[model samples]
Target: MWNIMKYVCAEGIVYRGLCGHRYADKRRSVRLWVGGPFTHQIHAVHNSVPFSQTHVVTSPPWRVLFFGTDSFAEESLKHLFASSCCRQKAGSAVVKLLEVVTLPKDLPVRRFALQNQLRVHDWPNVNVQDRFDVGVVVSFGCLLREDLICQFPYGILNIHPSLLPRWRGPAPVFHTVLHGDSVSGVTVMQIRPKRFDVGPILNQCIYPVPENATAEELGETLATMGAKLLIDTLQNLPECVANRREQPSNGVTSAPKISTSMSWIVWEEHTCDQIDRLFRAIGSRIPLRTLWMGEPIKLLDFVGKFHTSLSGAEAETPGTVRYDRESDSLLVSCKDGRVAFRAVMLKKRLSALDFYNGYLHPFFLKKLPRQQKKCVFGSYKTKESDTPLGREAAHKVQNV
Candidate 1:
């Protein structure tokens, strides 16, 4: 007489035995039956089951709520929107629903969300009753409270433009360029309440900073790179969350928001490279400023270091100014080297040629002896000396 028995394996496979004796499979994934000495036959019937007949497990699509404000954030939103549309069409959606939350002011993310017809929720007043699987924050300025963060199943993921523990504030890209860092990258992390960018890292990709890359150029590159990374993180959300690690405490740094006072050119303290980096970092938003004959002048169109034709006298004085006719740029001597600018603005904007003829020429011709006939910048000081001029200056600066 034969006795029949069944056993289930960890891989969800079932095994049946005629002799009631269990044997381990070679791979250890399942158990097989071995006939006893008195048994007539032994069989392994379910070993070659077709994949179509077996049950397959798959992760469901995610419902995502995104928070963003600027152009940098816009890139990630675009990628997520595209990915959702493509996946839905393929009938295996990665993101089932997408929505955005932004501040009241007109921002890039808000504009893109409106233009694309995606749902937009005004920030601090967002409704979380729709039951989102995850939340994404990119360049979003508002702080999320603990109660709000608990609404999402996967918590919130932030696409920070810098490697964390370093540059933990509102201006990572600007600080990266300003400090002349050789390498920078984007990081995907889980957001924690009451802090910014102090979250566990999910993924990171290093990018070598291009030669003399301006903050604007670097920002654009990182923005695109970050968008792709964000999608990749979402694709394997569970795995990323499982393997996430905390940021190290050794390299902690802060990237404070750029201010107008940071644009001042102190000839005695800064070098050509330092000034060049400064201009690349924030010159587009706030022109480099300096005092000329007790009046404010804004430097524009930085043309980099003047490598050739340096006189001993000009090199001796840090604030000495000279016009390079060959390059058609106004060269200003810094602590160790000379930097060139294509234009300046005092009462009005003027080209290098116009500035040389109007302000520099008359000053050199009349102010000092021929041996000391040099036009200098930052020679005078006022309480608001470092401030940039004009009504169109940044609101932050204007208020200050």
Candidate 2:
């Protein structure tokens, strides 16, 4: 839905269109028309003022320039394009003109703009001559300079996936899940030059994080919510700008980008819950890693904590691996509890059954009788100074 504010004359003359249509009478009262997807006719009335001698006035549609790159940014661009199309069909569009700015690569937003036949401008190479009413940036990566920001009448608006003053960086969604935040949300804020996610907030909405939600799931939810919120913000752009407030100083935090080094799992140092959270946060992009028999292995299909018992489980220390025939899983002990995985990968991926038959069964048969410690998984040494022992070097391990 979109709103068009109009000034009403004392003679009850209504300004019929969005493009500054005016009557000769003096301005006295205002009428706000709430419009549907394809219709501009008034469906509801709000903030009605008493009519007197008033000149009729109207706000023109906006010329928007949007900047984006990833799937998260594509959602907002789609909404803006749809709204522009709807308004155009109704003879008065909320967005008068819409163009896109993206990197040269075939990113999500760039592909979308090309498919829709929207004018596309490559980043740092924009050639727009006419001034735009407003600019929008979402997951664009680059820090916009002050000279570029001065091109828009209303500056730029950003649709961020996290509430400002918290997780204020590129990997907010990842950190939110990694840190096990129970609540998360989206923020629509004005953009500032030479920095990121530090502008005054125009709008914000809270969304409750579902239990055991992965970063991908949380990101998908926030993307849709942010898109809808972006449209709503544009609908009330003037009022939003007038009423915008600076973000609170308190509760500030930073969310740095995810790194490959974070994927390594240290069985002796991390709890079951910590490892589970790490998998949910970044396992989709980077598999959870561990060292097996001094060789790197990737853990897959994480099945959370294991509850069933093995006959000699209590005797085995953390990083000791056991195959559960009943569940067809590989169970590894952590600092607090055990976690299960359905498959593991060294050179090629293998199911738990295959790994046990090919690698573990023979080794365990040879080592279990003698109660040798070499059969257990060990932490990979990431630094030159790190010791080869699993427990001693666990804290210093990095991605293998």
Number of clashing residue pairs in every model?
0, 5
Alpha carbon lDDT at 96, candidate 2? 74
The TM-scores of all predictions, comma-separated, are 0.79, 0.80
Q: List the residue pairs that clash in candidate 1.
A: none
Tell me model 2's lDDT, rounded to 2 decimals: 0.77
Top TM-score prediction, candidate number:
2
lDDT of 1: 0.77
> Model 1: per-residue lDDT, tens digit, 46-115?
4444222222112446789999999999999998888885445765567778999999889999999999
Give the C-alpha miss distance for residue 259 in model 2, angstroms: 1.3
Error of 2 at 309 (Å): 3.7
Error of 1 at 75 (Å): 0.5
Name the regions of candidate 1 deviating beyond 4 angstroms: 1-60, 85-88, 313-315, 362-364, 367-374, 379-400
